[model samples]
Target: MYVFGDSLVDNGNNNFLRSIAKSNYYPYGIDSNRGTATGKFSNGDTFVDYLGAWLGLPAPPPFADPTTTGPRILGGVNYASAAAGILDETGQHYGERYSLSQQVINFETTLSQLRTMMSGPNLSRYLSKAIAVVVLGSNDYINNYLLPGLYPTSFNYNPTQFANLLLNHYARQLVALYSVGLRKFVLAGLGPLGCIPNQRATGQGPPGRCVDYVNQILGPFNQGLLSLVDALNNGSHPGSIFVYGNSYAAMGDILNNPARYGFRVVDRGCCGFGQQITCLPWMPPCFDRTQYVFWDAFHPTQAVDAVLAHRAYAGPPSDCHPINVQQLALINFL
Candidate 1:
């Protein structure tokens, strides 16, 4: 599969690049069995890695890796980067990071190189069978809209307007990719931004309170994305295009009932904290990260991610609500 988008899906694109939004070094992957970092934003593996493993394929390589010199093409590659979003200003606040557009351009370049390495028929076959997974838009909301002061006046745009502009451009890119024989796609929707530790730290109300205003925008954004996916699927596209919904409800369920899913803490992060409620140097690391849902102020622990992934592949409950990342992957089998 061709995995695209931001840090959520990035295995190590930023790690190989000279970008500030990187997770390629020490202390990041300390939780893993190897206890060695692998460029993922979290302490362990990502949903993409889990999904790929479930599909019986080797985890996709990052597009930025210069050493991916091999012959096998059954597995795909990831072109995602930390803090990359649909807009140029998405990660400008942090400096010198490649935006989503740049990542797409890099993906095209990688595809070209792959085509050169393989015969025409082989390349065509690979493209026809491969699935493209896109998971993005979080940074656009978190950094661009939430932290717009860093950008120049000329690039300023509100959250709703910026999201619309991004979706429009993304539709064009999807169309272009469809024309190139990529038919099957799994488009991941935005997750609940309100529940993230960073947002929780800023918002008011009871502990573990979610910022409803920020989450309100996500519904409309996701609706627009669903419409886009429906349009693509209904058109003369070669393969099926499916929308994978992730957001408010699924996250809320897990947060509200942590015990049902085998978690102890929902609001407080697993990483030990000191004076600062947020997980940072001021705080001490948690004794056991598996007990908590969140690993840091922004991401989830591997244990929670595993459960979420299973739910994603398992499909919705009787109520028809969306499942987690795991259930989404199972749709391929269905």
Candidate 2:
């Protein structure tokens, strides 16, 4: 599958790129079995890594790797980068960061190279069977709209206008990909940003309470995304499309009932003291990461990633239906 978007989906693109938004160094993946940093924002494996394993394909390679060649092209590659978003200016206010458009351009370049290595039939089969998984837009809100005084002041765009702009651009990009050979798609919407450790630390809510404003923006984003997917799959787009996953509700469920998911701590992160500043820093290390749902301030722990991936591929209970990634996977989109 072609995995695209930001750090949430990035396996190690930031490691290759010379940027501060990188995690390919010490203490990042020190807890991993390999003992070497793998470029994932989290401690060990990511949700996409588990997804690739479930699909019976080798974990997708990072697109930034210049040395990758041959049969590795069959499974797919990840073009995601840290701080990338649906628009060129999505995260620019933060600093130097790759935009989502640039990531897609990288994806186009990778596909061009892959075409030279595969036979005609192989190429057709690969596109026919492949799935494009896209997870993005969180950083745009966190870094661009909320952090920087862009939307609330400079542009005067509220959450709704900003979300519409993001979705519209994202739709155009997806449509462009459809014009190419990409048929199957799995578009993942943004997860609950308000409930994340970072936001919780900054906000005044109780440990378990989700911030209302963040949820307010996320609801419309997911709704618009779902509507767009439905419109695309209605015979206008080629092949088939699926939602792939619903990270928001699933994460909230795990947080609300940590015992059910074998987690001990949902409020405090496994790393740092769950404080606003230290959670995003590199100095203070988190203590027993496996026991907590969140590894750092923004990302999920390896254990939670594993469970979320399993549920995404194997289906969740009825109450979560269309919101479940597993059920979305079973839609027979291929």
- Highest lDDT against the true fold, candidate: 2
Off by over 4 Å in 1: 72-74, 151-159, 204-207, 272-284, 317-334
TM-score of 1: 0.86
lDDT of 1: 0.67
For all predicted structures, in order, the TM-scores are: 0.86, 0.89
RMSD per candidate (Å) reads: 3.7, 2.8
The segments of candidate 2 whose C-alpha lies over 4 angstroms from its true place after superposition are 93-95, 150-155, 204-208, 277-284, 316-334
Worst window of 10 by summed lDDT in candidate 2: 317-326
Measured on C-alpha atoms, candidate 2 has an lDDT of 0.73
Question: Where does candidate 1 have its weakest 10-residue lDDT segment?
Answer: 274-283
lDDT of 2 at 156: 65
lDDT of 2 at 121: 73
lDDT of 2 by residue, 1-334 (tens): 7888788778887777766777766566767779767888777888888877887767788887876556676678888888778878766644555676777777778778778987877776667667788888888777677675564422666777888888898888887777667776777767778887778876656656777777777777777887887788677765666463677777878888999878898776666566452234456466677788887777787888888777677765422334454444444433
CA lDDT of every candidate? 0.67, 0.73
